[model samples]
Target: MPLPLHLLAVAVFAMGTSEFMLAGLLPDIASDLGVTVGTASSLTSAFAIGMIVGAPLAAALSRHWPRRSSLFGCVVTFAAAHVVGACTTSFPVLFAARVVAALANAGFLAVALTVAATLVAPDKKGRALAVLLAGTTLATVAGVPGGSLLGTLLSWRATFWAVAALCLPAALGILRGIPSGRTEEQAAGGPALRTELAQLARPGLLHVMLLGTLVNAATFAGFTFLAPVVTDVAGLSDTWIPVCLVLFGAGAFAGVTVAGRLADRHPGRVLAVGGPAALVGWCALAALAHEPVALLTLVCVQGALSFALGGTLITRVLYEASAAPVMAGSYATAALNTGAATGPLLAAATLTTGAGKLGPLWTSGALLAIALLVSLAAVRGRARRRQPLPPSEVGTPGAR
Candidate 1:
């Protein structure tokens, strides 16, 4: 909606690209750095670990700092890390760079969500978050695929160079686009850091975030291993991998778009419908893996439902923490990264069983079921809170 929001999305696009761009470049990175593919894949894990750590830590540390400065500095650090990765031949150096880059990515996202939320009106908070998060889903459609193509045409190192260079314009835009003044959250004269952190520990906020985490875990569990499902179970060619990716990404784009429209007004109804629909999608995904047409169709549906649910959950976290906005985005970021890191690990475990290529989909179903239970509990909790006190309890000062 606002120019500054678009500018933030521009930066998010670059950051999101770098965050997952390596999925396609891992082999090349391994070959160039003289390591096994397994070893090179650790870069992804390293980045996830860094993000899990950086989100809350960076947000808390920089809670008092200027938003523009935090945003700009994080972007610069991220770009610099990519430069190091592009130039370095040593595996350890590249690994370290990945971690640093993730730290920057996490910090930038945490603050950016807060800044985006603050910039818009209360009613449009969901729309604002969706606009920003669209960059990420768009990255799946364009940035990751583009990076892979760049690596194929040139070198994997060249792709890193491209990612690094992409941030330059974004950094400059952030410098000029975002304001340097105190936001409403800051102007509230928030409590001390210790108190702010304690506020985040409130059960309502934590319940919302936990729901977000479980939903994300389910989403990632299916997604991380989707390529194998396409090739092995769906009986598709390697050429079809990117095509399926495009379809899924397109669905994700559509999902967030729809989510942005209705999330604020109907979060419960949306989640109630979408959550079960997603569970069904996961079940069908596993059962239909052998049927390519069915499999591919489900892929698109899953993407849309997954991201729609995700966007809503993130917005709910913001709503839950509205009274104590400090570090709210950080907690959301932590939940996000926690899900990102754990989903694959859990799915991998399922894969090792007799389930074979369909394991991840099953894992997704199980995780979604858990998330839905949490959602149901949260709904009940809110209903309980909203109920008027009994007449006797209200009348007596210390009713038994």
Candidate 2:
């Protein structure tokens, strides 16, 4: 029986909301906990660190378990962590809960990707991944805003309670929809741990992982400071910032939708196009910081291209690490989280150095340009290594 991919997407939505809602709740949390804003912000850092460390650790620990069982356990743990966070009044306890929740989130996502891949045909793996990731896109579009609204209307702790409640339904869906037995690929057995680690060390695989990190870092460098950019540089009032965020989220949803249709057929081409598009968008944003309309347009484009590039990059990693998809997925998760952590620091440093509000945009553009060059080199390398295509693939654009 095929697993219900939508259920996995729902589970991802639950996790994404928990991961992102923290940003909106930080100030309130600090006020309630009687801590400095800086200390409250460390909760976000703790969650990122947990994700970075948990991916490989979870993969290794759950390597022998059935995918369905692993996912169920992770999701349940995630829900429990959120409950602890919601109920706790102590800052340290809530912070610890966030870390535990993040660990469970990483574990669930890694296993979910593996299970999604197994459910689909080999040629449609990219589409499956895109579908699974759409949950995160939807979270940005709907869940984050909803959580923010909930926090604003009630207390931040109430928002945590809401997210924890949502996780129960997601867990039930996973239990009902996922198969009880191991996937065929798992049953057939994959490469040994030694072989999987060796594959991770390959130059091509390493380059793809590096590209993933750079792509995410570039996106976040500017996005993490969007509130200030909109207010100070673009000359928009605070009221319009939420509108801009919605636009960015909409673009991200569109990007993932397009990627779902095209990625399996033209993964390389998608990367080629998306990488340069993001670079151009970031450059335009830096130069047009004073133009409100231009800033809004460029932000939307940047969001779309960044997410489109991300989907294709994941597909590339899966292809390159075909023998160990689960481990490769874990590595990709860790790399992206690494970028997520690094981007904000870089953006903050630029601000402290007295670079104007446009510093983050320019910084993002520079990083994106380098990632684009690496992607182009990778494409050329792949082409050089290929033999003449069969009659079937000769006419296919993706074959190139």
Candidate 3:
């Protein structure tokens, strides 16, 4: 791996930490800010909404900027946002800070993925992409857990300060590692964004997006309420809650590691397999929440299988886009944010109807099934068309 990839991974770790630290700090924030817990919870939702709006907007705006500069700017913006969030005692002020942090997170992720693609050979892109994306899993495992602990002991404000501190080092690392920004070289008969958009016009892309949306919605809905589900529904001991989260995060980390390698061989097959496995995992979780062993097993599997498709799917989008790596990165990030926002809202409605945790699982699984169908169809369509999506350009004349 190149030095730049390692630096990007570190940067991603800081971004992921900042993005998710709020989940663990909500209670602390609510109490300190003199707001209801529900109100504080809105902070997380607001960030997701910010990501949905920010990803594409950032990409469009930075279309001509040097990629490293774009990424560095985002990191600085995120660090500043965290400082503001920590200092603000006012609810509105903190909320505004969250939006800023979210925009930075969204923009950084989009640009980072585009940078990853440019840093490696075409055949190794999947693994390269995975290295940076892995920071997300690390955040879930290490950052979120540590933040939760810190919020409980010190102050929620202290947690944000810690996040800001971590980011400074990450930004410094990027400065030391990655080269000045560059772009992919064009292939003969290279396709333009319009051509890529036409490919997206196919039912396959629509289905893939739908599936991504469903996967997120179900996961978030159920995940948001996981603590209650474990205690209320499954009757598990509160002491064991961390065990489940650890298991889930471990699964996610392992999934990313494996998916990175597998994507090079069969992006479509990985999605097809992983989606159904996640659907089954969710079903098992709902059916056997009372069975500690079964629940833990399923949660781990759910995390592992569901996320296994992530790198592969992103690579697929970029490949299909015919070297529009930035566009693919932005749009995929947007889709992910859309799902992140939608899943919880939709799940809330389902749970409000007196439907148990299982309701979200059903919805999620159905959506995954749909996504799987779409993936399969896309693969079949590509096979039928006989010409695989064109190879991306190495350094398109004006890509940088």
Candidate 4:
């Protein structure tokens, strides 16, 4: 990856740690705030909700700002939110901080995607995005677990403070690495804001975005409950949760690396294989939830399958939304975050119904099944659109 892309990835790493680290900290948060763990989980929902609402709004609001300034401002806000989170005693304040941090994260991602594409050759945009997203994978492997350890060794507030501190250098990296001007996407964004908004509503782009959303929903539905599932269903020790997380993260890193290499050239091939495989992986997860050996293995397998499929679908979003490059990142961010919000909330509801850990696994499998069907439909639609008409139908009135 280029230095600029690497810097953006580093910034993403800083941001993603806060996003994923909450899963590990939820128990401590519940303990500290005198709330049930279930209630504390709302913090996870709050952040996703922020990203859901923020992606498009931030993209539109910052559309006219210099790319570097927009990115720098977002990171700075993200840092400030963490500072507030660390200092707050009230659950409501902490919850509000999660939303603020997520808004910043969403804005940075929205701008980062456009900037990343501009930093690389047109043909390499997929890889560029993969590299940027790889930051999240790295965060999963390192930062998430690192935060968990920090929360364990010191305090949950320590995790917040650490994330706040990390953002300082990340803000500087944005100012140093990202170019200071109207980006290429901004230049292509016609004077009318409606032009960019129209892309979100475009059926083809929406289809791809929907596919991305479903895959992510399936992935997160299982992931959000990992700590509990490892301990309760698999009968593993709390110490095992971080190890499981590392395995899943390792798998995610590998999945995204392969997607970066193949998605641009073989998007259909990847969709054909990845969708069904991800669905099957979820099925295995549900079936093996009680078997520690099998459950742990499935975690890694599902992670790889989910991210590979999800990453490709997102790459398709960029391809489909190419006409509105400035808004493409917003579309992707909104898609992923929508799933992030929906999946865990649904899983949490299932848990409240006394479905046990199997509920989340089933929830994940069901979402993946829907994703598979959507993927198949999308691939078929793309194929039909690309297929040539017969000679007799060529230039015919009916064909037209």
Off by over 4 Å in 3: 27-40, 184-204, 234-241, 356-363, 373-400
Question: lDDT per model, in order?
Answer: 0.83, 0.79, 0.72, 0.85
Give the per-residue lDDT of model 2 (tens digit) for 1-400.
2558989999998887777665456667889999964466567667767888888889878777888799999999999998999899999999899899989988987788777887888898888988898888787677766776677678888889888888898989988998888766567676677877788878878888889889887876776667667777878775566556666667878898898778888876788778877888888888987899998887778778888988777777777778786587788778777776676566656765566767878889888988878877877888878767689988788877
Inter-residue clash pairs, candidate 2: none
TM-score ranking of the models: 4, 1, 2, 3
Q: Compare candidates 1 and 2 on lDDT and give the better one.
A: 1
Query: What lDDT tens digits, residue by residue, belong to model 4 across residues 76-193?
Result: 9999999999999999999999999999999999888877877878788789989998998888888888888788789999999999999988888888988888875567655466
Query: How close to the true structure is residue 361 of candidate 2, measured as C-alpha lDDT?
Result: 83
**Count of clashing pairs, candidate 3:** 8
Displacement of residue 223 (Cα, Å) in model 4 is 0.4
lDDT of 1 at 107: 95
**Which residue pairs in candidate 3 have backbone atoms (N, alpha carbon, C) closer than 3 angstroms, thus clashing?**
184-394, 184-395, 184-396, 185-394, 185-395, 185-396, 186-396, 217-343
Q: lDDT by residue for model 3 over 1-400, one digit each (tens)? A: 8988888998888877766565456556777889865566577667778888888778767766776788888999999998998888799988899889889988988777777887788888789878887887787678766766676678778889988998888888777776664554332323455654465575555555666665665555555556556556778765455556666667878888899998888775787678777878777777888777888788778767766766566666666554455566776777766777776566545655565655655556665666667666767877877854344743666533
Q: Pick the candidate with the highest lDDT.
A: 4
For candidate 2, give the lDDT.
Answer: 0.79
The sequence of per-residue lDDT tens digits that candidate 1 reaches over residues 1-400 is: 8989989998988987887676566656777888864466567667877888998889888878889999999999999999999998899999899999999999998899888988888889999999998888888788867876778678888889988998999999999999987676677767667776776668878887888888888887787677678778988875566666666778888999999888999987778889999999999999998999998899899989998998898898888877656677887888877887777678767766899878989999999999988878878888988888898688787653
The better-scoring model by lDDT among 3 and 4 is 4
